[model samples]
Target: MKKTKLALALTSAVFASSAMATNGTNMIGIGAQSMAMGGTGVAAYFGAENLLANPALIGKSQGTELIFGGTIFAPDVSSEHNLGEPASPGEPVGKDSSDANLFVVPSAAFNSRINENMVYGIGMFGTSGMGVDYQDNGQMFRAQSALQILRFAPALAFHNETAGIGFSPIIQYGALDIHYDGSETQYGTFGLEDAGHGMAQGLGFGYSIGGYYDAAPGLTLAASYTSGIEMEYKGQLSSASQPFAEFGMIPEAFDDKLEQPAEMKVGASFDMGSLTFTADARKIMWSEAKGYKDFGWQDQDVFSIGAKYSTKSYWLAAGYNTGDNPIKEQDGTTTEGATINFFNNTFFPATTESHITVGGGMAISKKATIEGAFVYAPEVKTRVGVSGIGDDYPIAGAASGDYSETKHSQTAATMMIRYNFD
Candidate 1:
């Protein structure tokens, strides 16, 4: 019933798209309203913005609702590599690529019911996408920092007592600016300090679709998919000391283009009187995504499950997920970077890991509910750079094309607010 603008942009999602659910499921893993029940809203989605999670679940909405939230990411991305043998002194010593700092995100959404079985909505949010800052004096790592995508999407859903489903015609707007720090010591150009800031490119026009089924009263099944988004940009390539500035001399250089592929998800849920169980499987089509139109984005897949319990006063829940490397590496060197990076995270020797999540919500008053959640991912050991790049800066552990094998973990806290009309 109200005019909307902010939510239209939310369609782009928080990280890349909620389809990944790794970065912030607090918003969509449970949708906004369902989050009030703790973070398990797969089979049961209420409101329009949440439709981005499972359109069919929006069938649970009544009247109109507006939702908005954001996530603050504190990534501890640091690691170490072997200088040679286990007996060698300081073999796996400290490295420069640790923690790129912290990032805070802001987002919003809106929705309304068309009837008991139908609902329509729009949203703006982020997904499980990763961004790294290698600008710390080139340390020889990739100085690649990415852009944030602002989305605009419209969706419609249908629900019945027996089953429900929703579809959203989406248009994601993406803008990423990359800066690479390269062989500053190799070329004489290093005389003029500068990190190459590739001009900003626009990646737009992507879509998503999701659905759910109550196969039975206490059982629900769900799945969703998002299309790939492509970005093309042109700008001067150079790091401090005008290292890459030489390429800029061409003058006729075209914008660098990168493609971000689509993603898919599948989940299931069951309700038993006072407690409910939910689980999900997700896929990221990073394979189609290549940087500099050459390097490729690995295909990533994740699986997660959660349980919820409710009492007369509040509710609680928890979950877990597993991840693999997207960087398809063969020899010690990586084929993904424009010039050749020895320590790129995409293909570096990284370890697989699983995380733990727990959270709960309480009734604030007759018209509102407040919720909070916490997740502590397990420590993952992996390398974090391209082979040649690290050695160029003569960075630690980069010379022999060895990955900086180290530990990494991530966690987040969330709060949700809900109110009903007087």
Candidate 2:
């Protein structure tokens, strides 16, 4: 179709590569209520989203419950190129912005109590993913990319009077595409048209385990663990796309191995009268994962706290969440800096660090409820210093400086509808 439409599709592909449905690259929370509460459902109860959080929560749910909803995500991304101070009067500074800004993600879950001690359920949701599509500015850094992950999980939970445990085998589907201009790269060995541009898709499997225990009156302790998934994408690049293609070996097929990271979370919730408070701590092993580590990512720790006030007809919640930036700063082109490998900083910057969330739920009827939440993460910026090319090197369209930087931010809103079967 149109150029922007094609770019949008490819951008979505890039979004799938990261597990960033909510938190940093992993969704901070699954359902609207959980998101509103700063993704604090780990130790608390959050209806259907528990399948993605703690499978044991399915057994804690009341009668048959179903939730369906989606999020409207919007992100702002920009980049700057720092080419030392102006040697001449009124020299221009380089800057650019991403063209793709809005994306829609969907989610759903169902839980049914088979007996007093058992619960069975199914959930289909988007785990995490994000990307940027920078329009052509200078020839060196123009790139477009994105990735998204969809998960299907069938879960089971068992519970008694004091504790409950649950398990779910996860099936995930992901796709990715990247486009960058390679000809102008200062590091010529980092070929683009050859190894950088193209599309790929893959399937993988993983599992999650979790449980919860009632500690005292109106208080509970909970924990969950998710395993990593390994996937290999079979990709293709066209002969007309970039570098001249050699008709060898399937002509267009290539493979990329991507691994989604594992995570552990612990949390607690206490309720007194009409107010409930929750706190959670989570650790994501990004550096141990395949794709992220390959791109120079570091492990991250996330912390969140939230409070909810409940009345007979409505409930309101607010919270804050923060984590470390996954995108490591680009060191100078020293031997140490050269060891830190990163690709497409302008097109795939994952830099947002903290969020403020607020949300509320309205009861429509005895069987149905609707919830909505808003999340905001302010701007984050980083400067990257590249090796190779230096100043004044563009000898008749040859090469220039390798210094660059980027600034990025995000805003998202989500809505969900829940139905109760009695």
Q: Write the per-residue lDDT of candidate 2 for residues 55-137, one digit (tens) a residue.
A: 99888887899999998888777765544343354442456677767888899999999999999999999877766664365
For candidate 1, write residues 270-376 as lDDT tens digits. 88988878776777666565341233235676666677787767887766656564544434443223122233332122233455667776877875666666655
Off by over 4 Å in 2: 1-22, 83-94, 138-140, 183-198, 236-255, 335-344, 387-402
How does each model score on TM-score?
A: 0.74, 0.84
List the RMSD of every prediction in angstroms. 8.6, 6.4
lDDT of each: 0.50, 0.70
Q: Give the Å error, residue 99, model 1.
A: 5.1
lDDT of 1 at 67: 55
Candidate 2: residue 1 Cα off by (Å):
41
